[model samples]
Target chain A: MAGQPHYREAHPLVFVMTHWVNLICMIMLAFSGFYIHFPFFPGFMGVARGMHFFAMYVIIINLTFRIVAAFTVKTATDLGSREVDTDIKNWLPQEKNKHQFFETVKYYLFLRKEGVISAKYGSLQKMAYLATIPLTYLQAYTGFAIYGPTMKGGFFAAGTTLVGGPMNMRIIHYFIMWVFIVFTMIHAYLANIYNFNPSKIIFAWKETDH
Target chain B: MAQEAHGAIYDLLAVRGVSRRDFLKYCSYIAATLGLSEAAAPQIAAALEKGAKLKPALWLNGGSCTGCTESMAQVDTPDVATIVLELLSFNYFETIMAAAGKQAEDNIAETIKEGNFILVYEGSVMTGQDGNTLIVGNKEDGSPKKGTEILAEAATAAQAVISVGACAVDGGWVAAYPNPAGAMGVQAFLDKEGIATPVVNIPCCPMNPEWVVAMVVQWLLVADDDPAVFLEKTALLTKTYKDGITGADVTLNYPEYVVGSTIHDNCPRRGHFENGEFVSEFGSAEEAMGYCLYKVGCKGPQTFTQCPVTRWNRSVSWCVNSGAPCIGCGGLNWVDNNAPFFKRLSSMQMGGSLGNVQPGSVAAVVGGVAAAALVAHGLGMKAAGRIGDGPPMETAKKYDRKRMAKGGDK
Candidate 1:
């Protein structure tokens, strides 16, 4: 088997930085969020809360920037190719990804020996990636609904009341955090399963030639 | 005549050994609790002066433990006796009415017929077994009248209804998970039956006596014996519940001042929280120093109440002050929300045979399973020759290739 080519057009330098910010913020948010949820250790409630809020804000801002950059940045439309298109086109489903959805699933399940020809992201990948946007916002909304000071606001109060009360809101927030954690786990494992090339390009921005 | 009536109230207070000055001080305290200014104290006093035409009240018990009644007895300043004897004609209070059996049932019936009266309902509205779970008294033919039947009749005739305690607000402990008696809140049951009588909910495991008194005083001074006016004067927050029976939105009203702020925000040990000083263990040096109970499963942050300020049992001490974490008894579905009582988060109901499980344990099991599955999937990928530079990539789908061959173009 020949080594597949990697290109800088797949992930721009700006997106690399944003991805780094997202990764770091998610890690911190999860850690501090867990701590605040159940102060497993002593003497860190204030610090944990401060870190959780700080990370939450940073991740939200980073996510917004990434969404904006998706329209502006250019990235490769296909794996192992330098041919490019607007990043949003690749991030979202395109003509090339139409019928290859089940084929990609089949390939991963070991039913198919060859990889399916598709866009940079498979249909499942695109769907999962798209879900994070709303999931993140929902987490933040539920967070605000449970927070003591912000909870009094009519908007947050409506959400709290809709879900019955703050307890349910808190539970929703906790469950969503787990969703992120599991997503991260599967994402990291699958991204690195074949090789660390994707990681290298995304994290280190190192391009490789076949 | 008004002056003579006013003198009679003072005379009644004198007979009860409560000095005029003490009574005035109590009025001021109540005004303050109602979020009213000191000027409202005189208005409250004036309302009490006209207490000769005592507001007819019936303190009814449903599926209760009589904790709210016990809490009422703990009212310090004006004293429970003064409230019952002079300020309000409590026609049917089971705990202290000194009348029972047929006499007590007759009192409730007579009070309902009078039309202008306040109904102070305590405990969960037992709706289980067609409301047979709680039989309060005997009917006309010596048959039993369900507690719900009695409440519906009384609530319909009452001028205003006060749902005192967590039970009356949302069925408290009895309505916790796997609720045996099918207990529900008074407002919810009323909404289901299409009863339009407005409920004022004062939610705590045992109703706070100070809050009850403040609401009663607010009714007298501000509402001026009018239920609609009472709703207008006090800033009431309404919560909409979809009626289970009708599937229509049922709006329940609660006082804003009571549920506006969290116990954490008003907590006395908040300074210690900011300082990151916490009591990890009960009865430790940190506990003695009055550190925050956040680390010890204090539900104060999520619980909305003024318990920290109001202080239970005549301002002596509260739960956190007594070194017990807040169980969030002031919240809706409180027992289910804050139980395990000593943990930061409540155990989620997994339903069926699995029953209740902790949130942390669930998260851990999920994360672990996901990780394990990923590892197995990774190994499968490797076995299928999909690792390294990855599997062989096909140029096009078979259908796409067939289409291209047929066109013989591009």
Candidate 2:
């Protein structure tokens, strides 16, 4: 553990803060959302709805900010490396990520004893991470379609009709939340499986350098 | 004859103990429902008196419980008798018309031959068992005529078709899950047969009678008995849905005011909703306190109808006002969309042994399975000795090595 090299270039300070915001907002949104869906207890509906809406706006803003920062900020493209490149390059698929996708799968399946060599983020990880962006936006679109105030707007109403009706749109919104839950569970487990180094680096911004 | 017919409306109104002022006031109410200016009331009154020639209408019953007919009978302003006998000149009304059997059948034939009548159709268009589910009249060959055949013939000849009630609009409860009867709405049936006659949809379990009266008056005064003009003058919302049975697209025209906003927006108890006061249980103290019905499966938030504003049963009280949650009968495919009337969400018909399953139960089952799967995967990871410190890392990329061999940069 002492011999392993870690550097601040892997995850910039700005990203660390955004990651914390995303985590907090996700927890708050899910908790308040479940409450609003079917008030398990009485008297907190107003507070729950308020919290759900507030957390929704915060998460959406945070996600947009994080995406914009990716293009402007620079970070190490390779793990434990001092050399740097724009953060967006590391977030996207890179030359180092080429044919290692299958190997990564093989390693996870234990068909291979070692991990696949790739970019700062592995091929599969990059795909899953990129998918969340669109999924999150879709969650918001479905949410707005069922909401009383916005459901009548032309844009939202058209989408609602396309999906059948408001009831179906609501079911879609409910299902998307479950997708986020499963994704987060797997994400946390996989991220922490490797000695918790990724968590410490991303959350605490603490570098372990030799 | 024209002079005699003209006086008939006022004479009937007087006999019923209604004054000329009350009739004029009712005319103004209709004008308001049509979103017409107050100045248009006089013109409407004049139109009604002149419309004594009786543009002629045929009220046909299909596969329905006659609840819509019953609801229409409850209106007092223009009363059902005035509307059927004088206002519209209904030549064939099954429930109230004196002529029955062959006599009533002859009236429908005469109206169709005249070629300028309104067809007021109630209930679903039954197509099960080759449309034998509902028998209405006799064919030219003297055999029993299906309800479908009667509706098609009447709808084809009529200037316009007024689909009243949730059943006539979108099959209502009769066409709900697994619709064994193959019942469908009038619009859907017309579209399938490629009938080009225009349809005006007035929806509700047994639609509010005021909406029906407003549409009828709008046609007589505003549109001048022209179906095309009626459609042009009315503020209608076009709703299209895929037919569950035929899988074809069906379009319906709804008067905007009737289906414009959700019931929740105009709910008398909306303030209580915002204040977090809910009626959690029936007959509880909260119920007596007149709290919001949202908690007890009120579908008002998603159901688009002016029920709260118009009320029901002559505006005496609506569902929410009477301590019952709205079942969303005004919406298309309402029974399928908002059933289990007491639950927050409609149940999914899972066919066969499953019957109806609640959405919450489905979500819980899915979430539980996912959690259990993840736990098993974690155990597998531990068994494979790759839990802590994870799998070992590989060396340089294979692509990099291949590129270098091809004389590329290191």
Candidate 3:
């Protein structure tokens, strides 16, 4: 802790805002989505549906904004360094990240005693983060297929038919939510495992230097 | 001659105690149901009355319980008996026809040889045990002519095939999971056999007879007995589905108005649904209040059928009106897609003894397992002393190690 350095350059102000939006939207969407699936209590369906749809749209927009910001925004390319580059460079596979995927897995599993030296994000982290984009869009697709208004469109209807029926489409949507839940659980644990420096910088925009 | 024939129709209607006005009114009703203009009513009347020779027809039955025939019989306007007996020359009708045994068998043969007859098929096409599941008549060798054999012969020669009821459309409940009988819809069978006759599908548990009547009249008046014209002139929605049995693509035609919207979209209790007033249980006070059946497993939201507009039993009362949740019999593969009928979602048939399982239960189990695994992994991380400040960091990258092995820093 005495020798370590952390700075605001790791996660700039705008990226922190988008991260908060993502966190808040995901929580609201998951809870509201569960309620819409089965209204355990009365009189909340209307509100639950409204909240679910609102969060869905917000999350999609926030994700798109985050992706676009990656190209324009600049951030620290390496930990403990103030040198900056467009954020998209850090997201791309860097020379330092080569062959680090299995090493990171080994370190997490306790099979290796030391963590892997890598770029801004380890290989596993980058892949998981990138996968969320398509998975979120797929969730939207499945949602629209079961929805009454948009379901009749040729594009959605064809997807519904391809999945066999509306019921099957609903089941797939339910399963994808579980995938997100699992991903979030692992993400939160890993991000905070090595103390809360990542969270402090991402959430509170604070810097820690010895 | 045409005038004499037209006069004979009114005289026949008078004999049946149906006034000329009532007859014309019935034609107008059919015209409206077919989405035709008011002027088309008189044209329909002319086409129906100028029946010097009635269009030949054969009403065939396959793997069925005769429910559709019973439903058709209950039609009060013009009555199905009059339509079958007088309007169309139904040379062979297994139900409500006097001809039977050899005489009835001969009628089918004669119609096939004659050609140009409309084939109204009821029930699933049985191809089980290599087509021995349903036997219609004996072959010339005194063995047995399968229902599949009879349907193939009749469908091949017919100008158009009208597949009446959900059973004839997509095998109904007969083709449900673990379908031991190997039943399938007529169109799928025809596709497998390479029969080129265009089929008009009227799907429901027993089907609304009005749709059948509208199709028949449309065929006579608008299509001029041409199958191609029938498809072109009618407002149809065509969808190509893979045959469940043979895995072959089969295109089916449904009347757009019939399968156009979900039953819930036109349900009388839709106000209750939007208002969140639901009938939670059968025989409850809420049920008496006629609330929406969505909570009680009404498949109306997913089922596409105009049941609310065209009520069953001659527009008396449909499934929801009678306080029963819709079982979604109008949809394709309805039983498998909407079974465990009282629940919101369908149960998945988990083959063998596993039986039907709810989708929610499976999701709950998977989520539970995932949570438990995450907790155990957390405990493992704590035991490994990797929870605080994490593991030691590698000073050099894995690639740097190779560079160092090749002698010193890169």
Better of 1 and 2 by TM-score: 1
Candidate 3 residue spans exceeding 4 A from truth: A1-6, A208-210, B1-8, B51-53, B75-86, B352-354, B398-410
Question: Scoring model 3 with DockQ, what do you get?
Answer: 0.49
Query: In candidate 2, which residue pairs get closer than 3 Å at backbone N, Cα or C atoms, i.e. clash?
Result: A115-B392
Model 1 ranges with Cα > 4 A deviation: B1-6, B75-85, B242-249, B283-285, B398-410
Global lDDT scores for all candidate models: 0.83, 0.84, 0.84
| lDDT, model 1 | 0.83
Predicted candidate 2 versus true structure: per-residue lDDT over A131-163, tens digit per residue: 899999999999889888899889999898787
Cα RMSD (Å) per model? 2.8, 3.4, 2.9
Cα lDDT tens digits for candidate 2, B1-410: 22334466677777777777777777777777778887887777777777766778899988899999998875546563354236787899898789988888899888898889999999999999999999977866899989999899999999999999999998889998778899999999998998999999999989888898888877877798888899898899988888888898788899998999999899999888877788888999999999988778899988999998878776789999999988989988898888788888888878899989888898889878878977887787788777665555556665666787899884
Question: Which scores better on lDDT, 1 or 3?
Answer: 3
Locate the minimum summed-lDDT window of 10 residues in model 3 chain A. Answer: A1-10
Candidate 2: clashing residue pairs, number: 1
Off by over 4 Å in 2: A1-6, B1-7, B75-85, B396-410
* Residue pairs clashing, model 3: none
Error of 2 at B53 (Å): 3.5
Q: Model 3 misses residue A183 by how many Å?
A: 2.0
Chain B alone, model 1: TM-score?
Answer: 0.91
